[model samples]
Target: MTLVIGLVVHRSHHRLFQEAARTLTGVRLEWVDYEAEDEIRARTAGLLDRQRLDGLLLGPVPYARCRDLLPPDLPVTVTRSAGLDLALAWCRALARGWPATPVSIDTFDQETVDEVAAALDLDRERIACLPFDPDQPVAEIVEFHRRFLDRFGGRYVISVRTGVVAAFAGAVPVLSGLAGLGTIRAELHELALRSQSKRASERRFAAGVFLIAKPERSANLDRARIGLMNMLLNTPEYADGWIEDRGRRGVIVFAHQALFEAVTHNWVSLPVLAQAQDTLGVRVVAGFGVGPSARTCVALAERAANRAEQDDSPGAYLIEESGVMIGPMGPAGHPLHFTYRAHGAGIERLAERVGLSPATLSRLAAVERGLDGQAVSPSDLAGSLGITDPSGRRLIRKLSESGLVIPEGSAQVNRKGRPSRLYRLGIGAALAAGATAPAGPGDAAGGDGGRDGDGPVDGGRRDG
Candidate 1:
């Protein structure tokens, strides 16, 4: 087995190992900082959803209310002083023989259990002392030995250590753990630079979130990157207007910043990614960049997310037109007076795809004019549906957002001191048109959309 050494981060050990490194042969130096609960969770979740990290190190992080969020199989080592607080967690893993638990204590206070027990009225058998020679150089000192102390079944038997240590790593020998920390130092630095206790609000940029899949993996990691390219370069369903040069690493401001905060706070297991972190797809990492324009943030967030893979490292997947998931998604807000008036709907799959609400849908007949069968811009169509011109622009965006309509081509026309946009339907519209062919005489409903999933069109009667 290759040995990986990670520095301990906790309040138990106050000294730096004054010696050369040992674990770097196969391990990496992980940086862990205490961040707000949500940030930490999102970071870890984002990682775990992709790459597989062999170990995790939560440096000096207090084992507060965040024990359960971590996956049980992965080996974990923490550097916090209050072990007793995590008693329930210990009791849990101990009951099932699950691994991934540990602690680092000081030699001067080997008898910490007695003190900890008295404070909580618990027995000593629940806690055990994992030894590390304090005087030995840093590499020799262990951080999370308490994880192994699952002997003697007793309530509240946990460990406690002293002060912050340099590095604390967690691991899952058979697989990679997407380890992450609540980045505190960097946050403080950014806050300090801005001269505000709270962050100054700014408008976030329009970003895209999508899913992609590849046929193979390459050292160049091109399969996934190219998959991302396929998502951004050609599709005309969503964000077609701004596919510029593959959407470089521009700023991704989010309205879902609040949602990211919510997810990070709620879930554990930080992210461990292994692909597309530095390319045309880089702009989508803003899972928590929330502020004034919150809805936009939500929209962008709905588009991007990280998913974990097994066997090897993790990969990122974008669920756009060319990504893992295809077809149209329900656009937020109402269409005409109908909340479900978003396009990609109509007979056959129409009612079943969208809950029936004829009152709201009848308004679509008023969705402005393309002059008989004349083509009109998506923006104008959405406007006829009551959305502001710019917000209506979302409907005009392409494949990345919805697989319902693909633009045949785009052209610009100048009219009355303003530019008029022109567009022709692509694959999605064509599909719907083909599918909408009138049903035969035996057809029960005038349409043949999604009643197929509900039941057969044949009328079933009582056997009286």
Candidate 2:
């Protein structure tokens, strides 16, 4: 039987190690709160001197510091991030079974070299650290990742930011540094211990909240719609809040169905529910999708969240798979299906045309593809009308005056903030509804107008 010793540098980590120590038949977990560098190496040596001890496990920090004192004669294992020769050496020691517990410390610096060095300690020159700068941006990070993959022939990165993820594709699988089904629980032990000693650490948590409801009356619809809008905008106005709310720019509050309900029939307000870490607060960005199916509706809302965060129009933020303001309005009560059929073809057309919001393109594509006028909410018409986020109402007013789209019903004015406008289809809607032939010669057709213009996709303009 082997005797294992776990050198816990922090007392708070005891419970975790005690449980893990049970996995090894003869392993014994112990602690030494090393406040100094010498203490770290001394404690490690003391454990190594124990003849019955078969292996050693070192804490991340202390193991990293006193790596030289760790014995080649003992089986050693260290706790740390990947990419270190010192770690591999300690692991090798443990794999072979040792005279004492193996101690190792892991550090971010020269991890690749450290791991390679331990594995090929016999040939120092051949063990080298690969090129990398921790502060590189997304593009540079991607390049670094590619180089790493090429160097190792088969390797994966532990963590990556959102930007580079789309570029890496299948070249590698993304893995978080944290692992284990009960890892959160285990990490909590370390965190609590560190906290007791007054250590500073960033918060690690996220949360989501969803508000659901149907409008019963125009007043209820007004309150509920404004309520939702106020909720989304609330976050940016405050230092901290439940939601990292998006969709504040092109918010959809009172709309056709909502107006009808408020003015005519009554509807129920759905409850709001959320889930997240106790430490982390929740943030929300409301999304609205118009469709016959619940699936499409939810999809629209999800898109709303995306657009809001990116500072985009809610219409462009979601998915629509039905009739368009620019195209033929689907039969009432069946907008979802019409949108679905027209959405893809519209997107392709949009790539060629440019300037139109996804909503505007959607509406225009619908019209060009079909015969009758499709549904054109103020928001949909605004998208089809190519109104920038700040101009949702102005575009609606312009289209209404131009005779492109029409409001489904009356809308309340918000004098305290931006004035709320109603939807009305007119000539603008017709132009959107009609499959516009490529504009003759040079009418500024698909010209450099708004974001994602002839301008760069990643740089200025598009970010908004």
Candidate 3:
């Protein structure tokens, strides 16, 4: 699928951004031009409403300007000049016989101004640094630069902000503080990767194969197939070709893995199927499977369907490629004992006790179940979560901090090199320590394992 990204730019740099976007492949870039920062705020609701956009790029303004305004789930990248770009621009100006003294520079913070001065080996006093708020008006920045030029007698200006550059009006030789093509391309590449990662995390793959027991003379197999297909088509996550008939006695349906997950959380799609079963006076048995590949899903689903057909009761059954069985879902699609169902509430409570959101808790539970109680490395967790390894590491760190998990051992995931550390579920310990405040005495222990008030609180070893 072509990844579509939104590029929000100021009126001034529309051409530049458009040219850059034209060079990208495997991605569609949509440009949304706004006259001012407020315009962006005004249009945020509309921008977010565009469901087709996979990510967003904010131009001119720093991400700080509107980061809080955008949807938290949408990946965003802000165009800003890197330090190397600033250094190069300064070098170019100086090589062109521009005086280094009395240089007026516009930047986002004082720290950057100091870094620029240090990088250029210029006296700090000679560099008139004018700091601007990320959300401030361009006119204010222009006025600040004008005052700096007058007071410091600067003959040259370096500005990364698009708004500040527009106010130049030929008053002084202006050097662009914006990042060069190479840097911009690198940032875009990073953003694209993030967008792809998000999409991967959201993608769900599952398929189900069904077999109908020979029914009374009034029921029709062809009509049942049509009804099943129609039911699947009505759901947003499933579509055409997602369902098909295997034979007069069998049928198949493809869907996102999330469908089964939601069923445990009270989604009533299963009940609709039960109603159909009752109306048709036919016993329907289905087998569901979730896998990374279509072939694997179909194979597992078929195996499950066969198992269901052989069973005495008509229900849904899920079989893992590893041969794990979890079902016997009744006509209403209620699984008697699904792993997710068993751990879901525990995870919710754990999340609350550890100050984590339910979403994170759910993801953690998924990882734990996938590992089958085995210790998992950060990389393994990252793969399961469809996120970067670093993100997985960060999440593991948070879980450890919450006393919900403990480091266990290390294992080599690759052919060569030292093994990576592993962690196991410490839910029992977490529950035991649930009464303790998050900021327990161990907060100042400095990785020293000696701070022990009681049970699980002391179990957090630095390398346990």
TM-score of each model, in listed order: 0.19, 0.20, 0.49
**Candidate 2 accuracy as lDDT:** 0.36
Q: Write the residue-wise lDDT of candidate 1 on 1-464 in tens digits.
A: 11122233332221232122221222223333323433444555544443233344453332233445556533455433333434343445556664323322333234543564456565454444443343343333332332332333222222222221222333211111111122222322232333221112211232333332232323334444444443322211111112222232222222212122222222221121212333333322312212234454334334543332211222222232223332222111221111112233343244333332322222222222112223456565553344456644654563214333334333333222444445433333433454545544433311211112211111110000
Full ranking by lDDT? 3, 2, 1
Query: How does candidate 3 score on lDDT?
Result: 0.61
lDDT per residue (tens digit) for residues 91-209 in model 2: 44545553112111112446454554456453443222323233344566566566655664533443313334446568654333212214323443443344322211112111122
Please report, in order, the local distance difference test score of every candidate based on alpha carbons: 0.31, 0.36, 0.61
For model 2 the TM-score comes to 0.20
* Stretches of candidate 3 exceeding 4 Å from the true structure: 42-51, 60-69, 108-111, 130-132, 207-237, 240-253, 257-464
At residue 126, candidate 2 shows an lDDT of 26
Best by TM-score: 3
